[model samples]
Target: MQNRLITCTLLLAALGGLSACNKNKGGKSDVTGWNYNDGKKSSGFYVAKPKDIKTGPGLVFVQGGTFTMGATQEDVMGDWNNVPRRVTINSFFIDKTEVANVHYREYLYWLENVFQDPQYEAVVKGAKPDTLVWRSELSYNEPLVEYYFRHPSYNYYPVVGVTWKQAYDFCIWRTDRVNEKELIDKGYQNQNVLKQELNGGGQDNFNTKSYLMGEYQGVPGKPKKNPLKDAQGRPRNTVKFEDGILLPDYRLPTEAEWEYAALGLINENPSPRRSEKQRGEELISNRQMYSWKNDGYDNLRATRKGNWQGAFLANFKRGNGDYMGTPGGLNDRSAYPADVNSFFPNGFGLYNMSGNVNEWVADVYRPTTNQDEDDLSPYRGNEFKTVDVSGGEGNLRDSLGRIKYVNENDSSLRNRFNYQRSYAVNFLDGDSLSSSSYGYGITTLISDKSRVIKGGSWNDMPYWLSPGTRRFLQEDQSSSTVGFRCAMTHYGAPEGAGSKHKTGNFFPTRRQKR
Candidate 1:
């Protein structure tokens, strides 16, 4: 009409100068997935996108050193109550085993098929686990109290009497069934919630960032005939520690990170000339109250298949009419099943640490807890589901009568250390040996019946299997000789390998003298 309106007003003024240079290059392209950049930043770096690390939760680590934790001068039972001391531990991760009984009967069969709905069935029958108090008269444990926790061949042993708050509520139902199988492998659950609930339980929703952004959905939460594709198609989960993905919180090892990881002495490795002498042992040093040195297996040294028969690494009941082998040879399946990898793992791989059962440690019994504990990683105790009314979230108690402490930095306390009052204390620093006492501060007139307990049971006696023998009960006790194992801390390590001090060596070599 006027040359077609001047070529439609010059194509509407070149589409209004391409929409004002995309509104000065930032108003974001009118929506459809918008973009004037900041899609969580892709170039100046901020691309963490996270969540892909998923697997099945594996990690085991442990490391750290500076031993002499409690009694390893061979402990002839002067019952000095785990004296020795020294201390230092850090680096963490655990759970190589020891939470068995068919993985807590799949958390009591998913809390009895999702609390059979009777109004959340008393929190699923109070998440069961009093397996009829592992029954016994003098013996004849009634076929392990009627088929060892519903037999599956005792599904890899270890799960005895429970309690340490039922293995911390089975590590919170194994971190909510591994983040609900990473939210139904990313489709945000539509099925496969452990094979369609296997009878009950299902509606958990699940959507972990649309499977960390790939957009998962092989039918899981449904949708994606082609919705951007990728959708968590690969990573099944469990390699753990490529440097992320751990959040589940089972916690509980702090009696000096369980006697500095039951003194495994950070499992060696050196050789690379940091003053390389090779044999005199310096790089990773010694320590070792029981994680390995009585040898038998886990090879910290003895290369080319040479050492390790020194045996007696753990599984007590020996030397006084002995139990596991001699006395009519092979009694009660060699005295209530040993070999859950027999023994020797410490320097962080973990394993029995000293003997077997006898664990529970979150510390609370304050026998003046080594002057005032906490060089770092130190611990006292608390249980009532580990308190945490929020305020700082980490939580610690004390002040009902007072004793708390805290130093090394004091960001309002998560851990600095100090604890020791479950009866039996001379300690102003005195015990462990006697140097005219100087424990510096010491306090604990008795706080509700002490607590701490560490590696060494299976009917104990190898000098209480030394991992710094200090014992206690009442916190709603439970024992088959006590059992517990779970820890986790190492979250990245950069600030000078997360607080330095790796070199080792200690135990009976001499120190407790004061």
Candidate 2:
């Protein structure tokens, strides 16, 4: 009541605007007769049912469907890793272009500013991409090591020398930053606090999970702008995840999601044409060898009679010592990784899915995990963790000011209502109790730490260009050939299209025999 009276401006327009009242907002509760978003002492269950979530920036929505997720072409290298198997992928959003040098530099700038204190200097240094990855004992590419990352000339080029772990960390930072912006935009958080934190080098940096879990108590927005209230109709400042404001965590795309996206199979369907009652024919008879077309080992170039006739479509080595084609007719046009925006995009309007640079994905490299993994959204690198909230409201957090997660192991599951098996990285694939074949650092270099790298790099051969073909490297190790892109899990309808032009039939719920 004190806050309500204090905000005389909002009080004047209380009847018109959505001001806090002792009643529900509008919707009646389905479970109970009581109302929702109601500030009443009897029932104060705030609920937010947004029509649809805002798609994250630079993301292209890839519709979910069943696809043959393994090698479409002959595995010439004789690595029986990616065997052909039908698997379904859930709808998710992926970055339209690979993470470029400019994008990464922005992240580094933030880290440098925020973690300016001497104690946090290691955080800044660790985030920097390995610029020295460009050096090779045989090659004279010394200039690239100095200029590639620092120079503005390669701003839009894909950021290489980023390890799988670094790429993963980048995604975590991105999630907090993106969500922080969202809160600021909605007037839930004070926008000036961001600049203040940067300048002051404050440890109270805004993190999405920390904010939601009541860990970080940063500056709140104006009272009138917030307009939230408690059960007693007093002003409530904090925003919750249930309020439908914050976004899902931005993370590395799972290997299945990455491959499914790389293979832009949408163009293969006859989706351009649809009927009144029924939609277009949902069919893909052929498995795509490359991201460009269904054809195997053909001229993947501009065959149409125009200025760009016979131009190379992707960046890949044609043969040994063939980085670029020739002096006059430089096929693929790029000797090294090309500008991310310069590539002729695949059918999904996603650039450099087949080349430019190989990408880091969220998966433990197991040769036959696909055979045992779940058919729906198949993946293998799930080391389950719970947000550690040991001290009630005050939770343990990282240097970035996010919730410090406790590994969801068996012993930690004592007081927990829910459960997830922890450290399942090599559970069925190469565990001591399970299969003893592919011994880590012994029988094979493959280990739980070996993360999957997808899509062929600029120096890679045509055989590696296939979406199904995969390779792996140690998670901590960085390479000049490797880069990464981020992905976000999609909520609501898989179609993404709303009710108006929705495809497929929605049958009525079956009456339960009481």
Residue-by-residue lDDT tens digits, candidate 1, 205-247: 2222222222223234553431221223322332111113334
Q: Which window of ten consecutive residues has the lowest lDDT sum in model 1?
A: 42-51
Candidate 2 scores a C-alpha RMSD against the true structure in Å of 6.8
lDDT of 1 at 478: 74
lDDT of 2 by residue, 96-132 (tens): 9999999999999999888888888888899999999
Question: Largest lDDT belongs to which candidate?
Answer: 2
The list of candidate 1 runs beyond 4 A from truth reads: 1-46, 49-66, 77-89, 93-103, 107-140, 147-158, 161-176, 181-192, 195-258, 261-356, 359-454, 469-484, 493-514
**Cα RMSD (angstroms) for every candidate in the order listed:** 25.8, 6.8
Candidate models: Cα lDDT each: 0.51, 0.79
